[model samples]
Target: MDYSFTTIGALIGMAVAIILIIKKVQPAYSLILGALIGGVIGSGNLILTVDTMVSGAQSMISSVLRIMTSGILAGTLIKTGAAEKIAEVIVQKLGEKRALIAVAAATMVICAVGVFVDISVITVAPIALAIGKKAGYNKASLLLAMIGGGKAGNIISPNPNTIAVSEAFQVDLTSLMIKNIIPAVCALIVTVIIATILSKKAGTMVSDQDLEKHADNKKLPTFIQAFAGPLTVIILLALRPIFSIVIDPLIALPLGGLVCAIACGSLVQFREFAEFGLSKVAGVSILLIGTGTIAGIIKASALQYDVISLLEMMKMPAFILAPIAGILMAGATASTTAGSTIASQTFAQTLLNAGIPAISAGAMIHAGSTVIDSLPHGSFFHATGGSVGMNIKERMKLIPFEACIGLTSTIVAVIVYLI
Candidate 1:
């Protein structure tokens, strides 16, 4: 892919941003500065650069709103016992013989219902540690189970990544999710397989000393109560596509939070829980704005067409190219949402111009972002790794497992969307 000065300059800007992120600079700041740098070198117009950044940020408003609204649902599940109940019930029903699959299923379902992958991993952590201790699975394998499931469910989730791609491609969110299901399920299956194979090794469980134990005095919500909220949210969101009901995610997501509380008889706690969820929204919104600047710079510089020309020269079709772009961007950032954001921003139009449908293109790129998204630099790696008590080496050992799981899903999407 030979690039003109502008294309190369734009890439340099993105690289600078990635470098800043690696140096622990806040992503939003890194992105804005990077966009400015790219504008100067690529387009050589300071005024245009600022305008591009604003335009980019403005483009993200719809996705940001949807993402913020999701916080209530995510927060509700996290603070309430609903998330635990969902995990517990799934693991219990699957039984010990299928322990790896059970853990993967629990984590998958939790994230699929709109929770963030990091939160999903952390929520499943204590449970995963407990399962490892009881089942004598390796701590690495247990960590693998939780994180893998998080990646699996994330593609179809109503979380930031899903929202960003859906909006970018100008497709219905539910339609994107429907397109993502096969990929998500394929990733889940890969998680089970990899974790089970890893379970065969002689290894330590999560350190018993640091493991959080459940109090026998704790009263868990009934399974029915646990299912009530997610089911309600799912039903409501589905009405739009299934029956043309026009309930927005802003309404559907928070409503599900309240339903979860009511079903669990925790209406008294709803205020604090919803507040907890909304509190996290501002930070995410800021990160997304930063994401937009990068997308904006790339768009303004016409980086997408440069990429498309390169792919054409290589004789690659746009379907594979979109997923590859997602993988590289996500791997560079070590974050799914950021990766998907950039991929959709830079490549969505390219894919569309190449004759791929919006829904199909969005699904492939979203799923691809999950590929290698938990590389060591990303928070998902550190946060989930810390929760399961894995050291750097132990965590590093599982990168292959993560990549395999992610690639499996990407492959599924490529096949499904390659029409």
Candidate 2:
């Protein structure tokens, strides 16, 4: 039922999807169309094609649910004023002179609490911009700083990309999260340093002056109330690593949201906050399903066999190939979740079959997915770049720095895998 005509069929299907995505079609719709074409061509059997696509989608149901609930936790973190409070404290302690580090650190923390990377950038933009202005740093530097931090945090956080890869590889969520921390920290440090260097050379870049500003007078939550929810999530999720307890992210993310709702006294507005978070990831959740369909088609195709054969011919290790697969796919899709999802579903099994450890391979692939997940075709490129008034040329500047940060984690993961 799989691996026969996959090479040509999956190639054609993926080509169609990439073209549609480039033409500004919604990724979900584009991917769905890709699946239909790929399915029919790969198997020439309508019933088998439908079954394969459905099976692939069904494979992602558990992960998708976790992603949706993460929206609840991420939403509550923002709605409760915790995200801002955390950012403000970090920037204040570091002082304006260290604004680049301060902003990147704050963003890393905010995103560590399961906030999507694009939203994390948007959330940190105001503070980053203000501090950059005070410190004579350009908008591009600040934007890059925030983005680099986001890329760093995303691999370790219980974000959709993390969830998809973890589920695909059958690794424990907490174990996967815990295993990635050191690599994330290393990547973050590199990201901040690069961004700081970029600031020195900013020279005559566009300013943030024309960007519209908004005001809010809502009472800020006390520091304890603000920090409590995220801290609890981290603690509960860490038990598996620290003490061998097995709390799944699905359990931890919603529980953290509930705590945030209660501690921030936003329990009354719980529904609204949850809705807000879901709204942000609504497109992403659908995109995950769409990627799943493509993943299914590929699974039934011979594309994987060809790729593995090439790797073997080059005497490449599966661990190294794993990350490359992730980087390329995510780069192609311009979305981490989709990239990691497809990479894991299509290649993780192959890697495992080649004797790579699931958790290690999963960790490497997860980091690799973040490396180029923000390409121009995806919403992340426009949404994040547009948020800070970046035109196409300006936005392109951030890609290399962002990739380096993610690549740092991926390299560290490869080392860990080898060890």
RMSD of each: 2.1, 1.7
The digit string of per-residue lDDT tens for model 2 on 1-419 reads 24645688898888889899999999988988898898788778878777888888899899999898888889998988888887888888999978889888888888888888888888888777677766888877888888878877888888998899989999888788777888888888898888878888844443556333623566778778888888888999889887998887778888898898899888999899999989977888899889988899987789888887888899986668789988998998988889999999988888898898898889988889989888899888888887667788888878887888888989998887777
Candidate 1 per-residue lDDT over residues 295-403, each given as its tens digit: 8888766577777778789997767877898899899888899889988987887788789889988888888898888887677889887877668888888898899
Candidate 1 clashes between residue pairs 3 or more apart in a chain or in different chains: none
- Candidate 2: residue pairs that collide: 3-300, 6-301, 6-302
Model 2 misplacement above 4 A: 1-4, 204-215
TM-score of model 1 (CA atoms): 0.96
